[model samples]
Target chain A: MTRRWIRWLPAIAVPAVIAAGVLIVPLSANAAVDLPAKTPQQVLEMVATTSVDAFSGTVVQTADLGLPELPQIGQTAGSGSNAPGTDSGQTASIAAALEFLTGTHTARVFVDGPTKTRLQVMDSLAERDLVHNGSNVWLYDSAKNAATRVTLPQGDATVPNDGSTTIQTPAEMADRLLASVGPSTTVTVGDNTRVAGRPVYDLVLTPKSADTLVGSVSIGVDSETGLPLQVLVRARGQQSPAFRIAFSDVTLTAPSAGLFDFTPPAGATVTQQALPQSNSATGHATMPAAPPTVTGTGWDTVVSLPAGQGTSTMLDSPMLAQVTTSVSGGRLLSTSLLNVYLSQDGRVFAGAVPLSVLQSAATGR
Target chain B: MLGALAAIPVLIAIAVRVTSGSSSGRGPAFLDQITQNGLFVALTAMVVSTPLFLPLTVGVVAGDTISGEASHGTLRYLLAAPAGRVRLLVVKFVGAAVFCLSAAGSVVLAGILIGAILFPVGPVTLLSGDTVGPVESIGRLALVASYVAVSLLGLSAIGLFISTLTDVPVGAMAATVVLAVTAQVLGALPQLDWLHPWLFTNYWLGFADLLRQPIAWDSFGSNAVLQLGYIVVFGALAYSRFTTKDVLS
Candidate 1:
């Protein structure tokens, strides 16, 4: 018996070694190590005080919004002068834009102070980059070989206002979650974790209101640098996260100045268009016009615009028809990250909460 | 195999160039934007061909290697010639491997010709948003072609073994294609993700890693090793089965 077993050992050993070679993938390079814990308030204070800005990293944004099927973006006209108010076209563009926002996308991000930032979203062989350097902003889509340059209003960069549609980074997202830390929420220290190979402390915030569908929002703040490495959001009753944005790899050193510089690649189709000028006397460049109004605030906030506002040409698109279904009083497109309700009453309501939350807002407001 | 090597590349080159030239309106989402680059066209041709066309050709060639001789009553005569079963199987495997490499090489050659004529050849932009010089891009294309060809070794071995079991070439060929498609289908299912790494076709698309700036060796290395594993195990199985079998045909 011993001799027979020895004969088979070589075969078994070879396969076992090969299997190990294929299966062993480390989850994170930063192994779990002992780190000091801090209170939730201390974590929030650290986030507010963190000065490690002007860094570059690769971020992956994933939205699980419980979507039935991810919408496929078909042939889009290769021009940024696209009309924004047309019905079906707008809907198609919105749907296509939303598609880019949902999937697990890898983006290279660079932040050089508050006014200068650059993000390049990589899609297969194509790239879409957004660079905001002071007042001059450029959005370039290499897939279309098209570039759109817009100059923001002179003082728009200094204004402390909301409703602007500038691309949101992980730090801004952490700030948004932290700013909502008020009387309607309870904060606590959750776990000592590692993010992007850096030791971090998680601060968990739970909404006090039962009317809100948000279960909890946790921000992982780097212990030493105080920069938020990740922000995760989960809706009520869901086990997995609905939306997550995290740096897979990050560095605190300031990125180079040329990284934010933009010169369209040779042969790219350039469309020079100034943003809608504010009503000021000079009538110079202004911030892109803000989208429709939002009713209510905090976790239950509902952003509603006219039904045909940005649905553009996609209103009657068969592609749109395929991904969304009509519900009781509206057409509901649900993904793991957020739900959008387009009602027959000629209004589109969208929120991070559930359809029920949107419905309540639709009825109440 | 020679016929495939001669005919398939020209056919694929013409087809890819024509489709790329005319599909300006609403063709594939990305290829239209990159129509100006020949290297991209060649890369596109390889990607378009790998899933079905190349595999079909490989299946037929591998499937016919042994069974075609048996169906013609040549197996016994060949066995009588003192070229033992193990040696005979090895020769057949070498022939099938040569076919796989040359067939893939033919497509790459055709793509290069068409791309050079129909589009501009210059520094190529990789999927990672970094650009590599023309020489490096060609090297990456060669790497991609090699990876694709090597990835099919497991399929070749499987088809050769199946061919040994049957005297009808068509039946063996059909079995090989069906099994290849089945592995692909299983790999596509999200619920069966755990089974993917073990599947023969799982790492077939790992050639895309060559298009990355730094060249992601993680997937590329695993894929090469996995296919090697498949070749060794299946090659041994074929040797064991053929050596003990009776020459009844």
Candidate 2:
């Protein structure tokens, strides 16, 4: 009996060893990082003057915006429609937008120089790629077997502002947030942390006013490269971050030039598009009937859209009705950090504030 | 057994050939691509078989390892023939592992053969929407087969342990297959989200990562580690049970 028991020892001992290793490995990897301290101004300067570029990385974006989960109506419904004013088209667009704001998405980003960049959004059993090689830009969606090609005018360096390229990297998001820093924001240096296995300094930004739903925003700047590796935004009273975009893995070396060169494969529906003229040249033609207007400033800013931009049709969407509650003025779509109020008059007011604030804005009080 | 496994892709290729084309995104992943590039037949077959057929066959072969010998009253004779108990166990486990590899290999080989005959063979479009030449596509398919084979190692180890627990071969086979199905069912339940990463079946379909432009090896690495854990634990369990139990037959 003793011999039999001895033979069975490995079954218990092996699993115990594995369990302990799993617990200890992560703890050791997260051992407190130590880095030389820098003031907020120095870090801001570091971000503003950083010259490092031409890198490849895998980015992960996760959002827990406190929105109810909607049924996954496949990409077909949204991609098939071109008219944004029609009922199905509006509903499909809203559902697609909400879908983008809810789930965790992984994208591979490859950049070489200023003009050659590729973003590949990895989806389950499908993929979407936007490749910009100098003046040539190609957008390919595997699920739809569709490709769109755009040739930029000579000497134009900017990629076409198509809706397909909305998923931005941490660097892009951090640049936009840093541009808004002023007296209304309190910028401070937090503890040194590690992101994507590299030492980084955490620069924390907090809104001074309590009126804004945003509690704080933290940016992880790589110590060696001064590039923003991660951006985390927390909503007031929320323990976890409301939205996070970070590079899970990054390599500083430039990606191969072949990655930027894209050709629409056979059987794909390829559409050749001419780049839209610059906004300064044709600003009025591209503007909506009544362009959205902004009120307030800093984090409490509210964007109001007039009655004719399909706000009423969006409210009529069954998918939208499922998530929004009927408020006194109209329907209110509320998230952890953002609120949208659709007034009975078909005007829409949206802000990173409470529904009451959106209501007041909608009433033009 | 490999012939039976090989017939699956053959049947699929013929079916798709007869139908001329499958609507994209409607059926098994890569099913629509089979008509365009013959290489997709292998990928489609692997995806369809990974969930059920592969595991079922693996369970049968692995579960019959020791129990079938014991049930036939040959295990005691073999032991008395100077083949040490541990050596016999290791040999049996290795035999089952080889079956796992050949099973995946046969499906891929038959798929390519039948697909080449039935459809136009040319550049293959990866899941990332990038196209690769026929040679690279075949190489990717091989990697996918290897991934699927590695995925089954854990299940084979579990089946071997279950086989050691019983003298009835059929009972062991049934129990092993049932456990595989149970793991998959539990994995599908969102309520047990925390238990997902531990399940062996969690990454069975993750071979699609190999089809991406810049292959995502994260799933492959995680799946290997998870399977290695299962192998070590279950191999130890099978060792303890097989060595401790008396050969009464």
Candidate 3:
């Protein structure tokens, strides 16, 4: 009898495992555009085809970004790289920007003109999922279960690495170095190709700063695949080297509108960020901000308020440990390497963020 | 050296934290840290000492290499010795360069170690808009670091060059940093686009260029050559300047 049951165990377990997998499958299969598997063009196709409803994934791809290291050349420049996990924010933002630009992550980018308007929607470690839509931006920081919105400035070098709509993370600042790439910028083919099984071309951008830096960018593409493989930003003259972003595991599929869709929970708080006009969220909607309560705890302005409303909190104490910022908005309130936080309240939050990400987001803002 | 070493971690932590920006992402972490982040305070701390350290290291060496002799009134005696001005300058320049490298290296090593202790470093997981698997980050980061080291040769040379131009090592070190910063700020002008090609700092970015995917060897090589040229020119200039300058200390 035991032997018979044991044999039957395989049969029973097979169905059980299959059922278990079936349950597990749906967890990562959100209708969101977390498409780390799709190439840039494929992602564009996904944007073109997907309906306002279906599509999504939990995929993440990394490509080898070939950016030239900036040269410190003739200066006493180096931000100091001795801190360890301390730069986690900069690291995350840089990663996010790279992933978004290279299409290593799922994103919805809206460009109005060649150099005019742009917006990018993606996730951030600090603010959870965020949308850089025009001058108005929103974040759903699920961690703090809050939401925030910010009306940003344009034309200024507000964010790091972001020329128009994209932004750098806190750790992204770690990429700042003293390289000697001068003001002359050009695009050229690169040799360190073949990342994510794709071919790449090098796009070298010289620094606009008068600093003795050598800035270079290597944009890799998978030739046969015609997908962006990576983007590397280098500054050789800095005491510390620059940063790189690479893409791995790309797929092709149209993402449903649900990927960009966000709704505040019933009881979540919301912070509107004193901006004009709502996000015009085309899909399901979120909640509104709670009446102004004490904005935050005694410390931590970058905190989440009730009703998914978020306030930028940098709670430092004789009080906070570090200048740790907590963004509270929508369902996305969370800590970020950079001070900018995203929350679920249909808002974007940023206070003294990195210039790279600032540039990226600000352009959109 | 130890004080400088200590500053590296604090700076790294500040770099990591302040640059981490608002739960907001995408920008220079440093600016975020300084402008409106907690890391600013830490960075402030680093900046305070940074200015002092550069001079101290170079000063100690310069004083030992030059002033100490003067203080002992052995300037004439040393001049009387077989050491040519060029040889004396070479020895000091090389010594200062090595010190600069060592000082910078100390910070980097401390930073990585502190990173291991302070944060997760299983692999150097580079975060793009997407993410990298845990297994692959280390090798890539290692490559990144190597490139960084190569690129930093510019700064090292700058320090060396400055050291040779001045009998006062502290003055040399300070002057080097100032020149570096000035060049850095000036290198960004569209109007000065003409001047960029000749600037050595233009070549300092070669290491970062290597991080590009299908890394652009042509540009990278070009950048490397340009930087190498700058180093050689600067190095030679320092050599010549020091050899001919009369030691009046």
Q: Chain A structural similarity (TM-score) per candidate?
A: 0.80, 0.92, 0.35
C-alpha TM-scores of all predictions: 0.74, 0.93, 0.36
Q: A1-365, model 2: which lDDT tens digit per residue?
A: 89989999998899899999989988876788888889999999999988877999999998889886543445544554445445665565566678768757788999888888999887666778899898898888887788888888889887764454467889989999999998899999998888899999999999998888999999999998899999999999999899999999999999988888787888888978766643322222323467789998998999998786456666677888899999897988889989988899888888998887888787764
RMSD per prediction, one decimal? 6.0, 3.0, 24.3
Model 3 root-mean-square deviation: 24.3
Question: Which ranges in model 2 have alpha carbons more than 4 Å from their true place?
Answer: A70-89, A161-165, A277-288, B189-193, B247-249
DockQ of each: 0.15, 0.55, 0.01
Q: Which of candidates 1 and 3 is the stronger one according to DockQ? A: 1
Model 3's lDDT to the true fold?
0.39
> What CAPRI grade goes to candidate 2?
medium
Name the lDDT value of residue A259 in candidate 1.
61
Better of 2 and 3 by TM-score: 2
| Candidate 1 lDDT tens digits, A1-365 | 56545544544565676667655645343446577767777888899999976888878887766654242233244222344444444443445555645546667788888888777665544466777788887777665566667778887864221111223567889988787778878899776788788888888888777766678888888999889989898887778798888997887888878766676655466776645532221121121234577876666677876545325334456666777788988788776546788777667788766788888777876
Give the TM-score ranking, best first. 2, 1, 3
lDDT by residue for model 3 (A1-365), tens = 55544534443454466557657865544323221344434432332343322112222322222321222221111112212223343333333333333322322222222222222223221124454433545554432334555556664323112212343321122123112223334334333334444333333344343321235545444443333435565554333224455543333344333323344432234776533233323110222345322221211222223334212231211112222234222222112222343443334434322323322342343
Model 1, TM vs. native:
0.74
- Reported per model, the fraction of native interface contacts reproduced equals 0.04, 0.58, 0.00
lDDT of 3 by residue, B1-249 (tens): 646655755665656565553432223222222333222232223223333454355445433444445445666676778987657656665665566555544544554455555444432111111123334433443443344334444555566656555455456556656665566567655346567765655544333223222232443565556556545655665555445556665
Ranked by lDDT, the better of candidates 1 and 3 is 1
Order the numbered candidates by DockQ, best leading.
2, 1, 3
Predicted candidate 2 versus true structure: per-residue lDDT over B52-108, tens digit per residue: 899999999999999999999998998998878889989999999999999999999
